[model samples]
Target chain A: MTWNSWFSHGAPTAGFTGGPSIVSRNNAVCNIYVRGGDNALWQKAFFNGAWHPWGRHNDGAVLASEPALGSMGPNHEHIFVRGTDGAVWSKAWNGAGGWSGWFSHAAPVAGLTGGPAIVSRNNTVCNIYVRGGDNALWQRAFFNGSWHPWGRHNDGAVLASEPALGSMGANHEHVFVRGTDGAVWSKAWNGAGGWSGWFSHGAPAGGMIGGPTIVSRNSGVCNIYVRGTDNALWQKAYFDGSWHAWGRHDDGAVLASEPALGSMGPSHEHVFVRGTDSAVWSKAWSLVPTVILHLKVLTNPTSFTVDQMVASMRDVYASRGINVAVGSRETLDLPLLTDVDVSTCIMGTTTAEQNQLFANRNGVGANHVVAYFVRSTNPPGNGCAAHPAGRPGCVVSSTSSSWTLGHEIGHVLGLPHVSPSDRLMMGNGTWNITNPPPDLIDTERATMDTSPLTVNI
Target chain B: MPVTMRDVRAVLDPDEVDYSAGARLGPEAFDYLLALVRDTDPGLAAKAAYLAGVIRGERSEEVVAAAAASEDALVRVAAASAAALLAPASASRVLNDLVVDQDSGVQKLALRSVPADPSPELRSRVREVSAGAAEPGLRAMADNVLRGLH
Candidate 1:
């Protein structure tokens, strides 16, 4: 069976409860931890290119709720589980060695209502937040290989469930919880200054029963997801220095528990939940509503103008969920530029070498797509998404039609060629530039949306 | 999560993948290979099976056996090929079963996997298929395996 069936058949969630937690070290490695029917902490890891069988981590200790996971070192992973004894127990795993036996973090004034929210920074410090017996928020941290004593951050608002945590930058962190009044309330920690007063996010989630799941897309933006009173998934993001109004994903499923979210890359977030059908359902969001491509023309053949090339691609890609615009343009002086030179410079080069060249010649900022186009009559396959350009960037043909331009850019945006002929990434390397016909497929859209450089047009 | 087509495509390049690297990766790599053989993507499953054969140790052969019985012909062919490359004699039973597969492509690959002087069962099966198989390619492959038996 193809993995496509796994999406419909779902991950093996035969007897899972509470919210699932997912974390990743990179796009290629991720782990999902959940409470098993036996009330033990079970996790499935995605390593290399496939999901490993689910393994129990708590050494048969029955957990009272779900498990929260974080990494304290590049090779070290920690899973904090609330044991049936009401004390939070922890287990450590090293990439070099396997798992260490569960250790206790002592109780935090009282037992936890559910699992705590866990996050790690620079593999040096880890913070855990849980709801205390007093229905107030409590916190603890791990630093210098030791567990810090529990501290209270009582935000006056009565808490009913777990508190979610997200870090905006090196030292800035945000903790969000559902107040007794059903409003989403948050307080932040500025590593240099300490905790701040509870700020009401003002989103009424009146019937939210569990903690919210939060993830930062980058240092500048973060998103929060919660199950509304209507049992629908709702989201709100903090972007451009302010919080946006809450919006519904209209996910079209009744969630059985609080959602779990993690970013696969910048501008790409995936939300997971246990559906009423007892299956895991995941939805992906690509926050990049548009993208700017910086074109550095080594030389354009007299046959076609760069503007014509841009207009052709813009006309084709605009309808397929990406707005293409030029953020900057420049031309370079060379003694003699030839098609063979362009091909040799790109195809024969390594990504590091290409990146070095771009770094020396272009001042394009991070999160900006940059490409070097040449007036080549014989570019690699008429165009190429040469990885050496480095920054979600590439090298392409200046003479190719808008279709080829769009196809190469698609590669820049993390798309791969598909077998079908009707799509933009047709296997035969042909595309319909005139009609373009929504050539971008669903997988391509999802991949593009998750691009770290994807942004509003 | 199931492996995606994109994931399968990522490792298709022979130059990009180090076939022996998985064996050196310890348990985590072994777990990955185990899951990959059962992947829904037949191409990925086939490739992983081939890699498992190259990495030959512990549960690698077990993974190849499971993949050899997969419903997808491509996966079964890959498993057969891997089995031939690794423990050909141990793969004799699987090759015997595949030598008569309904899919001619599977039959050809399975016949090609027969070890020198393979089990009588595999040799007899290959003989039968070579005599009656409709596809010339399968017939040729079966005859080739029969030559080795002789």
Candidate 2:
């Protein structure tokens, strides 16, 4: 949840005129492509645990604006930019074929006024957003083994800057632009195969000064980072089925150009902005990974039942951006499993019967967590997060407090008990925590972020 | 050394009292909590009530029952749940009071606290709630519980 300080990553100064498009290929290698002062596309790669020296990959191709970068299935990367002739050109690279020579897709007759934004839905499909010569938004795609023709999708809004794109789902994209009205306007595919009208997300009071950069953390969640008129970094987050107000991230790093956002899956999202010093400065948010839990209910207590426990866990985990409630739930009529004997699961140990119950996950992912709801643990114990090694889960007492479920599961995700009752990992009985929403500190968040059970939101 | 009401309130003030960890306070703490539940601060009263529920004694059920009457919705809701853990002597009436509480959340946990085989009076109250409750969500919950009983 908190961002790291602004680190320049040894950003090149001269000829860095303005650029910094960042992408992670296969979530392993990060290639930061920027339009160099020499009007050519250059890159600095981070792989094998080190940053490589800056190198040009465009074969001295003259670019009219900054370059956009995207990846397809971890094997291929595509870079799109405006050529000297006002046409949009691309240079593709594949793991097998290395880098290919630049080729022109031929721009709209009106021509491209800014760089393109690229999103790859799958290995074969990619969509590009651009600011057209008419000052409206336009797009094209590469699917069915060929490039589609230039098409405009402004919904009657004129743009003052280039557009940023978010992937809502396969075959659906959301586009946001800094409209000439000094507001952020969005037009998205309705998911039912239709386009939505332009909707304004309201800008900062002084209005925005540059284009917006976006990174979709998942299907329903995306965040827009931009430089406001005050020269500060401002962001608008869309998640939980709605858009929140624009909040400023005042880290004291003044933005000099439009910001660009990229992420390595769920690890973190880095916002790269050309700072006042004309160097690419970046800050990143350590994103939380989802904890998928499968519950085995024993006797549903009068209070704090398994269903209520899961709902409470969802709200607790939301503080760190984990939608643990978004997973599937079904009723299986297995009588014996439905009514289990947790009698032997005492203290910090699980019984053989408990292990047998867990053994039949019924195709649940190994990385997913399973919670066994029982009537009670050993005397004086409401739950225990210990199971046989290699099987990660916990046993919960049906009478445990609302925070106990999350507390035990937090143990599964590498959290240790702390003294304060106002925390989720409180060693004391969760039943007595005064805090309604217990805290999960950053270090605990980092520990959970690295758990294999986590898939980034 | 005897546990004073101040000692009980001080321990309960900053964080919650988890006697379950180790009986730092005892059945003696229950009477002190009962006095503190009358504190003007409803938040402190709510905390006193929950700690009383945790340290159930002769007065624990009544402590939550009194908390169920606190003007604070949070206090009432917390009592609605804590009532399930204390004395079953007055459990039905306390739960029935909570099930029809003005707060839907209180009604929810109270409905949830209904035993697998409920007393006829509790079952009858559930039937009334299922037919007509202010919150549709609460009504649906009662309806579902009624169906499962069948």
Candidate 3:
């Protein structure tokens, strides 16, 4: 049967309790569990363009905790659901391995109140985090064929909500949970260093009333989105070394569900949430370069030549909500500027390389720019040859070659990747590169298509 | 001591009864209320019907059915839902007749009162009534009720 036909038959039943984590795997398979009328865990899976049976499993008792699904190994997957007894139980299926019998693990707490978030970074290791009886954040990891307790369970204020997990590395992961005080808090495990002490980032702008979702862009950066007390969507992000605002709030008609984050491209990520109306809504941002107009004078350069250009660009960007910084060489701060340039500079003799040279001369680097201008009428030969003054009207062309600078800078400021047409920085060569997309600067001057960056707590 | 019928009646103010608390009434307290439905009080039957509509489960079917068949239209509409959940088979006939009831509110409730898992015969009945019903609201409710069956 067609996918649409199959889905129509297995459409969700109203009043089926489901605060469970729904996950889609690499193979395009999605797994979710809803509480059936009998309170048994009812399972439904989407595979081969069809939904499987709404299997009702009694398993000797009712299930109050939400079920979590993650990869067990290559070509295999596992599902964990908490029994009414508050014990963690697991079920698994391997491609040619068939289904395994359910197995129970030690309970995280005697009275499991909320669902557990499970994530697997690799084939053999999986981690599950739960809110404990004392309202603390508790976790258990299945590694080397057995479940290992990380350390003394960390405490969250009161009524800890569901904890979401994001991987930092193969063996490292971070857990985010909402505290009783309505703020979001986090803990991390860095393999050799073990689990870190709990840290509170501060209350989300809207108080956390539901579970939070965490998605990592890379090892050091992650974002968390949660439903506020008013049922609006709120976010917190962790980037570089600091936590950003709990901004990017969206109020919907119904209670919002925990968000799901997916990577759309390098440095581009999208977050999806079930809105109050039960329709899926998403926001994304991709990095893009900010152009700095530095005039080059080969023979004799004018003072503030770079400063005037930076000031103009800053004004233009500020009016649009894009912030720009002027580079200074008085201190060793030049190294910071150099590091950005060296890392962002392209390594090739192609047109892209030439664009990188122009970009470097104009002050646009990986995440920022430092434009340089000379009026000697004698430009450096080869790659550094200056474009004629009246060619495109804008002399130093040191913006990003593929719009990578814009996209990266967009991310640095706080936007997640979005679709090309709606993106502020549609990378060059992939689409038209002559000018920025019309939607590049939203009314707020901030890129509207991308998810706003906030510290993930 | 068990909550007495007098205590239940005392808490239920005629003009402003709490439906949330009414939902927690036990079998004995419910029986006392059911007795009121049969009382000679002028609007007492309608009030009893409204209370019965929100108090779910199987035991309230008899009183709910009596209320659904009451001479008062509002009481009949409120009892239709309780009847549908408690005794779908018996409520089927009244609900079907109410599909074309002159009161739009009664017809609307009748439409929503269909069971989620109705018998095929009842489903066909709903489809036929909804497809041929004159009132747009009733027809829409009939269509929705049919969908719920599936």
Best by lDDT: 2
> Model 3, range B7-82, lDDT digits (tens) per residue?
5554443122345566676565667667766665413454455556556655576677676666655455556544
What TM-score does each of the candidates earn? Answer: 0.50, 0.52, 0.45
Candidates by lDDT, descending order = 2, 1, 3
Ten-residue stretch with the least lDDT total in model 2 chain A: A335-344
In order, the first chain's TM-score in every candidate is 0.64, 0.65, 0.57
How good is the docking of model 3, as DockQ? 0.00
The residue-by-residue lDDT of candidate 2 on A307-395, one tens digit each, is: 77888888888787665843444444332332232333333566654577567566667788877765433222356676666677776
Query: DockQ (Cα-based) per candidate?
Result: 0.01, 0.04, 0.00
Q: How many residue pairs clash per model?
A: 6, 1, 43
Off by over 4 Å in 3: A1-11, A27-62, A148-159, A249-255, A261-272, A278-362, A366-457, B1-150
DockQ of 1: 0.01
State which candidate, 1 or 2, has the greater TM-score: 2
How far residue A32's Cα lies from its native spot in candidate 1, in Å, is 0.7
* Fnat per predicted structure, each in turn: 0.00, 0.00, 0.00
What docking grade does candidate 1 earn? incorrect
Query: What is the C-alpha lDDT profile of model 3 across A196-276, one tens digit per residue?
Result: 877887766546666677777566777787766666656677787777888655433344566655443336555554554
Candidate 1 lDDT, tens digit per residue, B44-130? 566577666766666667777888889976577667667776565677866878888886546655676788868888888988988
